[model samples]
Structures are given as C-alpha cells and as structure tokens.
Target: MTADRITGITLSSVTLPLKAAISDAKVLTGRQRPMTEVAFLFAEIRTADGHEGLGFSYSKRAGGRAQFAHAEEVAPDLLGEDPSDIGRLWTKLVWAGASAGRSGASTQAVAAMDVALWDLKAKRARLPLAKLLGAHRDSVRCYDTTGGFLHEPLDRVLENAAASRAAGIGGIKIKVGHPSPAVDLARVRAVRESLGDEVPLMVDANQQWDRTAAQRMGRALEEFGLTWIEEPLDAYDAEGHAALARSLDTPIASGEMLTSVAEHHELIRLGAVDVIQPDAPRIGGITQFQRLATLAEHRNLTLAPHFAMEIHVHLAAAYPHEPWVEHFDWLHPLFDERLEIRDGRIHLSDRPGLGVTLSEQARAWTVARADLREGTGT
Candidate 1:
C-alpha cells in the first residue's frame, strides 16, 4: 500500500523558563537579557494513514508567536503533498518565502516544517531518524554548556565544572569575554583547576570581543589548554575570525547564529573556524544541517552542534566525523523522555522518527496555537 499523503498541520507556541537566571558574556555586559526565555514553535504533520510526526524550532525569546504564525501561513502548501519528498517541499517553502528574504525568522519557521516532514518520512520507513539518515555510530560524545554562564561566582563556576566532571561528561564549556578579561581568565583558570588538566575545557565568548580583544585575551588564555574558544568574534566577520584563528593555537568554533549552509560555507571557505556549530532549529532543520555537516567533514572540520542535544545526538552520530553535542538541560522539561547519556556520550534511540514527543509539562506552557488543513487558505 502507498504511504499516506499529508493531511493537516498543527503549530503551537511554547515557552520554556530557565531553571535560574543565567548570564552569558553578552548578557553580563548588558548586551543581552539576563534571563533566558526559550520560545519554541512546535509542529505536527498529520497523514491520511493516521500517523503524525512532531517537530519544533526555537528562538532565544519572544519570537515563538511569529514563528507559529509563519508556520501556519505555510502549512497549507503541504496539503495533499507527499511527506517523503521533503527536499522538494523544502524548496517550495523556500521559494514561497523568497520575496521576504531566504533566511532569518522566515527560514527558522520553515525549519519547524522541514523537521516535522523528516520525522514523518522516517516514521513511514519504520526506522529511527539516525538509521534513516545512515547511522555512523549508536552514540556521540556530549559536553555540558549548562554550567558555563558568566554570572555565577568563581567558586560556583568551578563547582559546576567539577559537577560535570563528576557526572562523566566528556567536556565542559564556560562563558568568557567579561568586561575585565582578567575575570574571564580567572574563571577559566579556576574551572580548569577544578576539572584538572586532562579534562577537556572549552570557552565561549559569544561573539563579544573584537579582533584586538580576541587576540589579547586569546593569547593570555592559551596557558590553560582549552579544546576550543567559541564565537570570539562576530559570526559574520569571517576575516576577523580567520585572523583570530591564526593568532591562537586554540581552535575557534562558531556558526550557531548563522542561518544557512551558504553562510557556513563562507566561514569554512575563509578558514574562519576549526569547529562548526550549527543549530538545526536556527539553520532550517536537518536537511540544511546535513549539507553543512558534509561540508565541514569534507574540509576536516569538527562538528559540534550548538544546542537541543536531544536532536543533535542523532545527527551528530550520523556524521562521518566525531561530533560533540552541547548539553543544556533547561529545555529538557519540554520532552516526553530524557536522552540516554552514558560514558560521556548520548546514545541514539531506535524508536521510529525522533523518538521523542511533547511532554504534558510542555503542553502546560503552550500560549498560542494554529491548525492548518487541506481547505485552509493562507
């Protein structure tokens, strides 16, 4: 029997509150909000066979309503379309939004749709997402980004790193680029001391520093043996990133804020970063992420996806190169199940599709929603 055609789509806006008010370098410097507000647009694609595939895309804050609206605006385009032809559907959506530019919030909204379509396709094939995408491994290594905020006291910073070490996490990333570079250096030193010299340590400046600041601070911080320094320069400043990369022995990792593989390719072509961190929710979902991952692999660059570890775990496992998934448990409340982490790596589930769905707790946080069916008009 032929697989069912697409029938309807549903979108919802969910708000995720941070466990605590966490601050990054940008936030501490008053460049960003002190509290993290996670706004996600959840999407569900229904088929004529009575199957539904779930997906979501998130914003740092306040954009979930718009994302949901955009998804609702585009949902009808998939009515009666083949869910398996995700690539073609993705192209159609992109072209439909071409007049409004091909990236940013619009593309992010498209990501919610693209992800759900992939989930539906994999479910129809009766294979887990990783296997459907071609599994390279059953698990991939993970690093904790939860403990690495700039607002915590130095002792607490060290304690966080120590806790992650105690939990068997492979590595930890700390926020950097404080007003006093000395403060940033001291925190890193303390964390490294607590975790010991052998444990992998990474730092994220969150694109707060200029080329000169990056050069000065990067040189000073080199004594501590870090795995990489992330986003020291702005995401679009490929030349500046290249210069900083050349100046420091520490690998510079970036691309989380970038919207497309084409943007990532520009960074890669400029030799800007050693590790590329693509956030699928921001980069138009798995289809675009796979393209970027392939490009990173071909260039011998490391793959360390930005966030949403639950999803990245499978994608990271499928990559030819060893990939690192950032662990941020703040959003864990949204999922029905917890990811299985063992020996510093996250194991992919064999369950069909993404193997996870919205939790009741997540439903409690829903603020707005939209439903689209075959007869609906944008």
Candidate 2:
C-alpha cells in the first residue's frame, strides 16, 4: 500500500445572510455598523484514494472577501502534497503566502485548508475529529449566544435566555458595554433574574471599555456571579487583562481576536485570563488551536472556545480539561448535520471526521468558486 496524495481541491466563497442586522458592543461603540451577513470560505479536498474532506473559515462584518481571495491565491500549493501531513502542509501554506505575513487574513484564509487536512485524516481513520485528536469526553458543556446581542431589547434578550435554558443549554452569555452604564447593568440584572440561580451565566464587554469602565462594570457585575467576564479590555492588552483578572472575583476571559499562537502566548504568560477563548477559524485552525490548548492547560486555565460550535465542539471535547462550547445556530443552514444538544452539552456523533457534509443550500449560497488540480486550476 502506498500513501495517498491529494488529487484535487475546491474552494467556495459563500455569503450567509443574517436573518436581521445584528449589533454588539462594537456596533454600539461606533467601531462597526450592524452586520447583515457573514462571508465563508469553504474548502473541499479530494485524494487519489477517493476520500473527501470539507472545512470552512468565516468572517463577519468585514474581511470575507479577503479570506476567499487569499485562500484562492495559496490553495494551489497543496496540490500533489500528502494530505496527512497536516502540520507541514500548514507551514507550507503559511510560507507560500509569506509576503502577506503569518496571521490575520493570511492565516485565516489557510485555516480552512488546515482544517480540511485534519478532517481528511480523521475520515481516513474512521473516527470523529475529537477521537482523532484524543477526546477526553464525548459531550462538551455548551452555552448559547444568539439570543443575547446588545441590539436586542431587554425583554427580547430575556426571552432568548429563557428559551435557551429550556432547551438544555448549560449557560447564557449576554452582551454588556453599552454607552450607557445603567442600561448595561439593567440588562444583566434582568437576565440574571430571569435565569434564576444555579445556571452558569457570563457577560461579554466585547473590549469596548477602558480600564476605568471595565473596573466599574466588573465591580458592579460581581453580585450576579458570572462564569467569566469576557473581553472586558482590548484583546491584546495582556497586561491590562492580567490586572483586571487580579482585581475581579469574576474570572477575566479574552483572546478570541488574537490571530496567532504567539499572540495567545502573551495572554498565557502574563496570567491575563482565567478562561482563554480561542476561535479556531480566526486563528490558524486546529493545528494552532491544539498548540494554544496545551499552553492553556499548563496554566491551569479553563478552556472555552469563542464560536463555530461545529468546530469548537470537537476541539473542546478533546481538551484534557472540561471545556465549554459556544452554541450559535447561525451556521445551521450550511450543513447536512446538526449538533445534538441535550443535558446542557453538545454531543458528538460517530460520523467520521467533523461529522458534517455541506448542503445543497450551501452551494446555492456560493458567490465565487474555484478548483485546483495538479498543474492546473479554474
């Protein structure tokens, strides 16, 4: 038997429309407008052995076009490469677009490719990605975010939290950091009361606050007993986050925006956070995520990946520590499968790889696409 090689690759740029314009702290703070859609880069890899794998990366509000463009530019480099060599291939793609640098859109573009290779390997082994990576559990604790954006009225936000709790979601996280401090406090109080006690609850400031504001909100928020206060300061402000962590009884959580392992290391090294929320797609995909996971585990920190429940569920399941997965149903329309949520957890299925297949609806949503074969692409 001979090792198989990748025979072809396909990439699609998908525009997924949000049901309504959604706003968060960034929008309220005037940094970005409400987001009406998300851009996705989906990569499908086929090997000579006829095994296929699918992976995708996404951007919201901005950078979707950049992600697809960069993936298209560097995707041909994977032709004829061994699909099982995920790490080396990741390094290969990074250097292929070295001039564009190693993080942000550059790495984000290739994240789909890195993810596809991992999926391919797991499918070949007939195991789910979590088992392929050595799962610590079959089901991961999950929380819902779709219902709690800053744009929703307090009543609507409370309704969302109530619905999620009834649906077996283990936790609820609501947005804070409105320009009006009183408004922020009121919403948190409302949801906390609606949820009652015993359910894990958290809040995200989305990095909209200065140190003074973060401290004020953090102290005021103490009575609710949150699981964590997320992104209370700018994501890269490791020193500031460390200070906030020390000052607050509520654990500080940040790092979803850091684009590389090196950037996340600053958080780990400074003891900046009690919970580290790394998004696999926004970083460099699973290879980079695994590296960050190990670093976080060593620090005895809680692991809670930011979003993409489909991807994060598997990664969280594989973590040695019990970790939480953000459950957002926004991407539900793109895939043929749905994650099983029961008993306040996201359960993994036995299906090989990521346990997902793209839907016809996904194809209908594609705006641009390409195919690459040995020595040729179209």
Candidate 3:
C-alpha cells in the first residue's frame, strides 16, 4: 500500500468575542479589555486517501483583518504541498518571500499556517504537541500577572500578589510605568512585603520609560528583589537595554516585540537582555521561537516566553531550561480545553494540537470581512 499525498488546502477565518464585560480603559490598554477577543485563521489540508490536517493563526490586535487577508493570499502557495513535510514547507514559505516576507506581519501570517500544520501533524500521530516537539518535562512553573495594569490601589496589588502566592504560583509579575517612580516603587515594595522574601516578584514597565526613568525606577525597586525587570526601555533600544542591564541588580528582560531569530541573535550578542520573552505569534511561530530557545540555552540564559500561555505551555514543556511561563488569566473561555494551572504550575495537556478546541459560540462572534462590510459587529 502506498502512503497518501496531500491533495488540497482550505482556509477559514474565525473570531471569538469575550463573554466577560470589558472595562473601557482596560479594553483600550489592559490585558482583558472590554472586548477581550481573538481572530483565528484556520487551514485544513486534505490528502489523496481522505486523511486530513488542520492549522490556524490568531492575533489579539485590532488589525487582525489585514492579517487574515494576508493569510488568504498566501494559501495558494501551500495548496497541494505535502503536509507531512512541515519543516520543509515552513522553510520554503519563509525563504520564498525572504525579500519581502522574511519578518513582521508576513512571517506572523506564515507562522499561523506553520503552527496549524504542526497541530495537524500531532493530531494525525495521536500525540500531544509537547511530545511532537520533544518533551523534556511534563509540567512548567508559572507566574501570575492576572492583576493587570496595576491601576488598583497599593493594598489591592499586594492582595493579588498574595493570592497568587497562595495559589502556588512560583512567582508574580506586576505592571509598572505608571509615570511615577515613587508610586511604582511603593507598589513593588508592598507586593514583596506581602509575598515575603522567598517568593519571587517580577515587574514589567511595558516599554513606558526612557533610560533615565527606567534606571531611577529600577534602582529603587532593586531592594525589594525582582525576578527580572521586563521591557523597561523601548523594545528596540538594545544598547539602552544593555546599559540598563549592566546598571541593575535585577536581570533585564525584553524581546516580546522582536520578530525574527536575526533580531534575537543581535540582542543576545549585544548582551542587551538577560532573559528572552518571545511571544509565539510575534516571533513568527513555534519553529522560530524553538530555534531561539536553543540559542538561549547555549548562552546560559533563561526562556520566559510571553503570553499565549496555551502555546507557551507546550513550548516550555519541550525545553529543559525554560525558566517560567507568564500566566495571565485571559483566553481560557474561548477554547474548549484550558491550560491547567495549579498553584502556579502549568500542567501540560495530553490532547492533540495545542489541546484547544474553538467553541461555536466563540466562532460565531468572529468579525469576518463581510461582517465588517455590513458594519454589524466588532
């Protein structure tokens, strides 16, 4: 008997809206904005003998419509290609448009297709994604940042940090960059006091400060002991980051906005950051992120990936030296199987293809291009 060859490819864009009420300001800048939503571009590949594979791409930003159009435009290149040769296909797709699509939105669109193909491959093998990626651990330690924005009062910030600690979270991350050094320092102090000296506390400024402001604020928080200071300066200021890292006791971490292995390599070589925080979608996909993880390992650095915990969980589980996965209690209700987080530890899933199933209700909320034309929904 001969093996079946891939015969065709199909693409669909799905959107899921948040059931929880989103606060106006949060909806604009917070993690769970009033319209906490996601748009996914799904790809399905069929084989000669009836076997099939499925893949998808998603983004939380408002420009997802453009991303969908880009994916649709690229679908033709993937049609009839061997779904089994995912690596080869990924390389070809990335190299095909090297001049025009090597990074940025183009690579992100390609990543959506690439990840979906990997999911289909895992499903066909009837194995978990971690196993497919070379599983090294069954579980990953997580740090909670569910208390986003840090707009809450000082007591409330400590309260949330204490709750995360009690939940068995290995650490806690709080938002900074409130345009107040004293206020940011006080918040970090309160959280540390509440969690005590042993529990790790991390802070993120969200790229809201310049070098002077970051250094002043970072130095003040150093006494409290932070796991790392994330994105203190602009995401693109590698030299500034290197300077800040040298000046501070807490490790400087950035790179969530970085888009390619080349960029990551430069940041690493520059000694710009001690920790690499790659967002799966932003970094082109698991393939590129995995390659970056290897580079981090070789350099004796930590891999603390950014959001999209569902995908990060699998990636963390596969890499032996992965430091910790950020846990933001968003995106759970949209998927059928939520990533299991127990007492700050994220347990890996045995389900195939990232173990996420899109609900019909969620899918129905998706804002298609036609929907935009009708102007009926967001």
Q: In TM-score terms, which candidate is top?
A: 2
Q: After superposition, how far is residue 279 of candidate 1 from its true place, in Å?
A: 0.9
Question: Candidate 2 or 3, higher TM-score?
Answer: 2
Top lDDT hit? 2
Instruction: Tell me how many residue pairs clash in candidate 3.
Output: 9
Question: 111, model 2: CA deviation in Å?
Answer: 0.4
Residues 113-219, candidate 2, lDDT per residue (tens digit)? 98999999999999999999999999999999999999899999988998998888999999998999999999988888888878899999999999999998999
Pitting candidate 2 against candidate 3, the one with the higher lDDT is 2
The worst-scoring run of ten residues by lDDT in candidate 1 lies at 369-378
* RMSD of each candidate relative to the true structure: 1.3, 0.8, 5.0
Q: Estimate, for each residue in 33-152, the C-alpha lDDT of model 3 and write its tens digit.
A: 444566766555666656555555566646477667766556556655667777787787777656656777778777777777777778778888889988888888899877645556
Task: Mark the regions of model 3 whose C-alpha exceeds 4 Å error after superposition.
Answer: 1-3, 7-10, 14-38, 44-56, 95-100, 369-378
Q: After the best TM-score superposition of candidate 3, give how far the Cα of residue 226 lies from its true spot, in angstroms.
A: 0.6
Task: Report clash pairs, candidate 2.
Answer: none
* Alpha-carbon local distance difference test for all models: 0.86, 0.92, 0.74
